[model samples]
Structure formats: structure tokens, C-alpha cells
Target: MEKERNITSMIAAGLLALAAVVGAPERALAADGAALLAANCLSCHSAQGGSISRVEGQRKTPEGWQMTITRMQEQHGAKVSAEDKRRLIKYLADTRGLAPAETAGWRYLLEHDNNRVETIDGRYRDMCARCHSGARFALQRRSEDEWKLLMHTHIGLNPTLEFHSLARDRQWFPLAVNEVAPALARDFALDARAWKAWQAAPRTALDGSWRIAGFLPGKGAFEGRMRASAAGEDRYELAIEGRYADGALLSGRGVATVYTGYEWRGSVDIDGVALRQVMAADARGERMHGRQHFADSRRMGGALSALREGAAPMVMAVMPAQLRRGETAELTVVGSGLAGAVSLGKGVRVLEVVSRSPDRVVVRARAEGRDGLNDVAVGSARGKGLLAVYGRVARVEVEPANAIARVGGPGDAQMQKVGVAYRAIGWAAGRDGKAGTADDLRLGYLPARWSIEAADEEAEKAHDADFVGHIGADGVFVPGDAGPNPARPKSLGNTGRVNVVATVEAAGATVEGRGKLDVAVPDFVQRALD
Candidate 1:
């Protein structure tokens, strides 16, 4: 409990740091946003666009700008008073906020604990996410040239980056400049019209009482009430009270600072536990949705939602969002005004409706042989909750197509072991005997057998056979030692790329899904808060 408290305190301190800093803005000469930036940033950063500076060409979220400003303050001794810093952050973020359309499909990546596997092309994940959280890249907007420049800076500063196992295995620099940079620019580029329209749009007001519901993994589902009142400009204080599915009472209070006029960042204490909240309000402010994570353990937590008092029936949550295809399971659907027939939508066969109430329902269901997101329905009202269907293992997909395992050495600095999981999904070949089409059924993850082997003769020569770690029966990857071995390539460091295979017998035939592994230096392994 003491340890938990300490973790909570650390989390609160980090999140509340900005709140506290901006709350007591120091007295300074009244100046507009541009003046504040000129005084604080224009010294080293050029105000206008040029070939030499990154600031003019780059666009970022408020959190991204905050990170950059904090780094500038700590590393380069950029001088700015608290007031000046606050103004500077606002100036930069307002001028550089992501266009709403640009953020449409990807906001969850920024505002919540999103576990839905992002289908990033294999090469980019190996090249980028291995070093930093994928959010680091997803949160920024840049031109092709800017993206290329960033890669050049990376290779220039960390020459080791190119020689790492992944880089050496592929044509890293050429692919990055030619394919990756262009892709990122095309996908995440700045749009002046979108930005201008968003700026001109009215912002939502998030004050007053609201009904709330959410899920806490392991602890189970919950329903609650929330009251939000003004704290400052674009900021609000939240008081939350709720009950878990097990009838355990829960409560919390926190102050939220809004960003992009929608993103909500809050530090709160729930039932003596510390947690940080990341949520987004819609344009109407009718609902605010996101997640909360335990302070100490980043991975622990659940989804959260808030609706205006007496709002229309909203399906707030559905537990076990994903169900195995062709397997029967009991699911709990939670929401307000859950009445009449509860539909699991299309692609799901409801065996029986076990029970129904205004706020909760239990039913037996078997998801059909389809792989995709399906919505849950109660009576005539639609829900925020989703039900996904994944069929049995017709094929196995080993995740992290490119994965890195580190030689976790002894003691505190030892790199952590990496785990690779195999997903067994059912896919059916369509009329042309080809796999890409609406007719292809997706069966989600299933039980499978896992193993590792050297991919080729070169891998064998590198002693990848010796370097490869043992995969558990449950498909966890355990690494070997951080070697200075004479058996491996000396200049390339002690690392090897192995092949991970997941096998399962389905439809009377053995099917397999393959993925690659990188056993490399500890430095490249990404840890939380890094």
C-alpha cells in the first residue's frame, strides 16, 4: 500500500506540475502570444521559415509542445518566467494544433491506453517505435523534407542507430528517406484549410453535472456520476463518484487541464489510489471519453466516460469487448436505458438473453466467423461500446512482426525481457483464392504453439541459435545475456534476428504465422516513461 501511494504521488506530481506552474503565473509585462514567444524562444529559434530551423515547419499537440519546451528549459537554458512559458506554450500550440480531420482516426493514440494493435507497416515499427513510444511520432505533423531531416539528425547523432540489428538487416537509410518519410508526410501533413476551420469553430464548454460509466480491468465494470465546474480558462475541476460491478463504492476528484480544446489531462485520487486521466470532449461537450491509468504502473487501468445529466441513453460500456468466433460466452452490457431487446448487432448470434435491466444485461453469445468491429445495441439506441468478433485459428499471426529481445544483464540497469505473442485468427480465401477483400473472415487471437529458430545461414553464423531466447509455452520471449561474445560479430554487437513461428492445427491441417525477432543491445529497448 505504501508503495502504491508513492507511485500515485509521483504520478500526481508529474501531471500536476503544469497545473501548479500555470496556476500561479508570475507578474510580467502584458504582451500578446507572439511577443511572449519572441522574448522567450526567438533567440535561438528562427521565427520565420528557413532551411536551418525546425520550429517553423513542425506542428505538434499541446503535450508535444510542452515536452519540447520542457526539454529546451532543461537542456539549453532557454530563459522564460512561468508566465512567459505559459504564454509561449499557448502560442505555439494554438498556432500548431492538429487539424480535427487529421486527428480524427488517431486521437485515441494520444488520449488513452489504446491496446488495439496498430497495423503499422513492418519496416516503420522496427525503425521508429523500437526507440520511442509510437505516440512520439503519431503526435507530430511534418513535411517530407522535415521528416527526412529528423531521420538524418537521428543517424548523425546516434551513429549506433544505423548499425543496430534492425538497421543493419535492412536498407534502413534509403528506405527511410525514400518510402517512410514520404508516407509520414502524406499521412500526417499539415492542412491550412482544416486548421483555419477548426480555429474558427466554437469550443465546447465542459461544466455541470454528468452521468459516468467505465471499466477497470481485473476489478470489473463500473457506473458513476461526475460534476465538472470551472477552475480556469479551459480548465475544470471534476468530482466523481461511482460503484464497481461488484458493488464496491468508488470516488475521485481532480483538476483537468484541457488541450486542443478537447483533450483532458487530470490527476486524481480514486478510492485511495492515484491515477492520471486522459480523455477528450466532443465538439458539443455532450460527452467526454478516455482512460485512467494507475500512477505507478502505467499499464493498469480502464476506459472512462461522462455524459451530461439526463442525457439520452448511452451504452457506456461492454465488458470483454472481443469474443472468440464460434465460441459461446456470457457478456455483460452496461449503460443507461438498456431496455427492450439487446442486440449484439450483426455477425453475432445471441443464444439467449439471460437477464435485462435498465442499466445492465447479460446474454450468451457466439460471434460469427468474421473478423472486425461490431457495435452493441440496446433497443433503438446505439452505444459507444463495441463488440469485436475473431474466429478460430485458421492461421496464426505472430505479433510484432519485427520484435527486439534484449540480453537482460544483472541488477537494476538490466534490460527487461521481451515477450512475443501469437494470435490465431480465422481467415477464409475468397472466390479468387486470394486474401484481401471484404469476404475474408478475421478470427481473432487463439491458443497456439510457439517456437523460435534461426532464420537463415547468416543468422546461424551469427550464433543466433545461441543468442535466441526461450519462448514460453504461453509465448513469452525471454532473452539471453548481454554478451561481449567472441562467437558473434564484434563490430555489430551481440545481436541476431531470429524467426518466430506460431503453429496451430485447424481444419485438419497445420497452419503457421511467422514473425521476425531482433536480439539486440539493451539501449534500444523502450521502457515506460523513457
Candidate 2:
């Protein structure tokens, strides 16, 4: 009967294998635990001759089968589902238990290697399992001295670890160093070479305004000029100044030293606070690594790179000669003392001189004042030699007449206001005397007629007796008050009169007079429609 059962089991296993290849093994077995086990396990272990054959025919306790199945699952990447595990265990325990010999071998192997070593998952096992699986020590790559210091720090934090045992700690440290040093040395060698190349290169000049992004504390933008100068091979000086994004003016200067690889050492000052930093470039040039030491001794590491090209001007400052008033004299003044010469020409005066490397002397006529046309001449100093000359006069015109009301009027929309606009027509002389005039004039009225009363007698008396006028957008003017206020009007009417007056002295001849009129508005006019 036993022989017949063995033959039958063999037949069943063979048929199951055929079913797996021909159709569906699970469908044919259909919850039949014995058939499932026979189909799955027969290819690797035969009933009477394989490694598991000795235990295949014998019966074993459920616990023994459970442990055996778990080992297979852990070590062999077996695909048995939870339900299959329970069924397989029940079948093995009931039909073919563990043999005495198999049990003895497994126990002997287990006892000989029972140190409770933890097994890591495949990923971590491949990365750091062999030397030290403890992540606290594995993740760090510090120098030998730093390692020692860190170990002592850990000992203080974890008093139960027996860190004072120098012999044990020392023994393990060398093993870790031996295992990790080669990889670290290889990394450092590559980095060192890169830093050396960066140090040998010339410092690049940053000219123009650059918008600095990715800064800390707060993201800020600034406009400024930058210059970089190399002070020998590895040292450099850098400077930048401009208004910050928040409108505060800023100026910064720093010095740096470059090393092989992309490593740089530098100290920068922002608003008087010094920050030291080490910089490095990654394998890709798109990024830069920075380690900064703050004033409080705290350190932070980050990345930086140029946000755009052509950021700031390379030059420091440029001063272009601009004519603010009278013609720009053609004389070219050279030398360190030329600045002083220019300073002497302030307040409507011009001094013509020859170009000199160190100083300038008046060569011909000293500029007295403007002629009738409000124009100045370019000539040589009285005794000095003649120099080259150029001249240009600035055209000054008054802004809109209404702009004055916006500056000086009351807040109420109903308050009546009036103002005049004028342009300087250059100096002129006439019957009244020498006086300035409104080359072009326009008058504007507010929404309502302004409150009218007698002129401030005391205020009028305080001024020069010869002049009694109200300061208008044009020059000061003299006029009689038009009776009472006009109703709220919208347009101005023309008044036939002159407004500007000037006093002048030329060649011992003194002249005082009023200026000719180009355009004029009556004293009371209504505001215009919007």
C-alpha cells in the first residue's frame, strides 16, 4: 500500500508539472494544498533524493514547518502569498513532518551562529551593511580627529554606551577608517585639482548694474558697479555699491583667496557686519556651493550662481560735462587742478583758461556778466595764452502754470486759485531799466474766484520800495486789483500789461526798468472746464 501511495504521489507531481506548462496550475490544483506543494516544490527537491527529501516523507510539528517556510521566504525571494504559507505549513505538518536528521543539522547550524546579527534590506545591505549598519556612524564622513571628537560627544549624550573604554573604541575606529578612507581620498584628490585650476585663472571683472538674487535674510535686488582685481595668484579684491531693493544705499568690499578645484576663501562685509565664507563649484558649472560663517559663529551652507549675464557696469563713476545755464565754454581744462577751476565758475560766472597738466591761469578777458541777450562770451584771459574754446547755452522754460496750484493751494476743491507760467527770454534792457521778462506766459484759474481783500500793506512795505509785485509763475509782476471776485468762471481773458522787472549795471551805466510782455491774463479769471 505504501509503495502504491509513493507511485501515486510521483504521478500526481508529474501531472502537476505538465499542468503548469500546458494550462493553469492553480486552476487544476484548485485549493488542493498537497497538489499545490507538490507542483511548487518537486522541481527543486525530489521526494526521495533531494536536499529536502530526507524531511519530505517525515512528519513535523507545525512550529518546525512554520520556521522552515519563513526561512525560505526571507532568503530565497519566494513568492508564496500569506494564504499559501498557512496551507503549506499545515500540509507539511500533517503529511511529511521534519526528519530527526534534518532537525539535528538545522539546530546545530543555528546554535553555532546565534549572535543575533541584524540583517538589513537589500538596498541598505548593498550600501553600508558590511562594515557598520548603524546609520549614526555610517552616514558621516569626517576626519579621524573629527571622528574621535564626535564619538566623545556621543558618549556624553548617551552615557550608557561606555565611551570611556578607549581600547574598544580605538579598535573599531581603525577598522572604519580602513574601510572608508580610500573612497574619501579619491574624492578629495579630484576636488583639489579643480580648486587649483580656479586659483590660477584671472579674476573676471563685473561691470554694470546686476540684480543680485537668492540672497538670505530677505530676498533683495540692487543696482551697483563691481570691479575685481587679482592681488597675485590666489588673492582677489571685489567691490560693489548701489541702492538696495528696499531703497537703502549699500556698499560692499571683500577679499578672497582661491584654491585648487573651485574652492574659494573670502570675507565680505554687509552694512559693517563681516561674514566669512568658503565657496566651491559642483561637477556641473550651473551651481556653486557656499559655506558661510555668520557673525554669531553660526554656519550655513547653500548654493549660488549668476542669475543673468551683463549684470553691472565695470567702471566706477563717469562725470559728463552738462551745461546748466549759460553757454558751455569751449576751453578744455586739463590737470588735477581743473576741478578747482571749474568750482570758481559757479553762480552765473565763467572763467576761460588754457589747459595745463597741474594748474590753470586766466589767459584773456575775465567773464563779467551776460549781455543784452542774456548770452555770455568765450574769450582768452587778460595776460595768459589762448586755449581752445566751445560754448553752448541752456534753455530754461517754466513748467505748466497749474502745477503751481497743486503745490501751494488749499486742500478744498472749492477754493479759488490762480497762477502764471513763464520762461526766461534772456537778459534785456529798455526805458524802465534792465529787467528780466516772461518770454512766454500763460495764466490758469481755479474752480472758484479766490477771496479778495486789500493787499497786505505791511508785507508790501517790507520789500524794496521800487518793487511792489506778487510772485507769479512767471517773474514777479505789478498790477492793480480788479474790483470784487468774479463769479465761478472757466476761462481766462487777456490783460494788456507787462509783468517782469530787472536791475542791471554795465560800464558804469546803471539801468532799472520793467520787461516787455509777450502774453498776459487779467487779474480775475474763472477756472477752465476739465
lDDT of 1: 0.67
Top TM-score model: 1
Residue 509 of model 2 has an lDDT of 42
How many clashes (backbone N, Cα, C below 3 Å) per candidate?
5, 39
Candidate 2: list runs displaced more than 4 Å: 1-174, 181-211, 218-225, 281-293, 300-304, 307-530
lDDT of 2 at 283: 34
RMSD of 2: 37.4
lDDT (10s digit) by residue, model 2, range 1-530: 65455546765765655566555533343335556565445554556641234343233334445655675666566667887786676555434432222232232111111112344444334323443333323222334444344345444555554333432444444433454344433422222433344334443422222322222222132333334466643456867554433447777788765432233456677667675545443333222334344433221111222211232111111111122234443322211112232322323344544443222222222333322222222222111111211121112222121111111113433322233322222123232342334432111111111111122363233222222224433232223222222321232122222224333332334433332332223212222211
- Model 1 over residues 323-438: C-alpha lDDT tens digits? 76677888878776777777887778888988877766889998775566677888855674277665433445665566656665645353554433334444544444556565
Cα lDDT over the full model 2: 0.35
